[model samples]
Target: MATQSPFPFLDGLFERIAQGPRPPDWLVNEAQQRLVLLINHVLMQERAATERLIPRKGRVVRVQWRQFFVALQVTPAGLFDLAAQGGTPDLRFEVTETSPLGLAQAALRGDRPPVRIDGAVDFAGDLQWLADNLRWDIEDDMARVIGDVPAHTIASVARSAAQALRGFVRKSGAAAGGAVAPWSGNGPLP
Candidate 1:
């Protein structure tokens, strides 16, 4: 039997938002700059990740979802900066999933959302390797900011909450007629 979302209005709401006017260009640019800074910070933590990116320096990669997009160019220091306007991207990735709720569910279940990739194959392989290997050490970062004991306790609590939420999401998805299978951690990326 087919099941429906308990909050069906969310689909309509998301559709409306997607069709609505985009945010101001300046605001978008600022947000993208902040995002790049965060990415560079994470990359700096892992020497291997920086080394992998160094070879791809000057490569422009653009990622898009709906009307929003960000173009990033790899730098000599193995960090990313905003790509110049009007330059063609060496690689482009467009996220295919449109529903915000769907994306959230996929994330909670540890699944990659559907994406359509274009451009260089070699570049794509490198990006796939990075994704597979790179993970932010949130606990370590927290420990540095706060103290070790408090950070450990807070991280433990957060982990427990996340696990509980994942379990609830899995149960709900299954009850909704298996719209998405439970993630096994080894499943193929979409």
Candidate 2:
């Protein structure tokens, strides 16, 4: 028997969100800019990640899901800038999962969403490497603003909460008879 969503209403809610009136262009632009800045900040924390991207400079990479997308171009300094509208992307990553709830569940399980990638082989390899190796040190960043002790305490609490949530998600999935298959990266996207 196919396992059903415990919260069936979430499906309708997500549908409404997907079909809702689009945000204004200015808002979307601002959000994308902030996303890029956050990505750049994380990249700067890892020298190897920046080095891996440096050779891919000038290449455009577009990531999309449904009707939403962002295109970024690698810069000579191993950072990313929002690509111009007309530039053809050298690499494209399309997330295959359409359900927001499914995506969130997979994330909670510490799995990457299924993605269809098409583009330069080397660039894709570099990006894969970055994904596998790079992680933001949120606690370390917090330490800069707050003192080390407070930051560590907060991080510890957050980690414990995340662990509890993951445990709950795992139990729920098992009870649901593994309806959501984990993405292993070797299979075709979706």
Candidate 3:
């Protein structure tokens, strides 16, 4: 039950794993990166659920930022030999006393490239789009997984990616721009 990607570009992604005799590092990176994004998404979902929102729509699982960040850290457990390219935390974010404008200027000079977290970020527009596109889908998906089967946010679904995907779907009825965080609902930002 591999979830059908909302974006068609991803269809070829999983299939690439078997095409070459030697698995591509890109494939490994892709899978590992997906896992990392999944980690972040689930963390956010768990938090949202605890806050008693819809409890289940997730759309941010495709970001590559985590790959850039996680590549810097190695697995503490030497069991499956992992790759660590960056420092401990892959994404390096620091609180600064600088003004927003000044901070933006300094961040422009920060190390990015493989460590993609330092890239210029525009949250306002993206948040608005997420609210419109994913809001209802997230809630409905949450109901199916966390509601009926009770899969914990971090767990990889009921079992494999297939089963997990069975519980995931895009809500057709959900309007675009409904994925509102509590802050968007006139609450304080977390």
Best by lDDT: 2
| Tens digits of per-residue lDDT for model 3, 59-167 | 1212232213233221222111233443233223333322333333233333123322332243223323344443223544666666733434433443456443322
Candidate ranking under TM-score, highest first, comes to 2, 1, 3
Off by over 4 Å in 1: 1-17, 180-190
lDDT by residue (tens digit), candidate 1, 63-119: 998778999999999889999999999999999997776788899998999999999
Off by over 4 Å in 3: 1-21, 48-190
Better of 2 and 3 by TM-score: 2
TM per candidate: 0.84, 0.84, 0.21
Better of 1 and 3 by lDDT: 1
Model 1 TM-score? Answer: 0.84
Best by TM-score: 2
Superposed Cα RMSD, model 2: 9.3
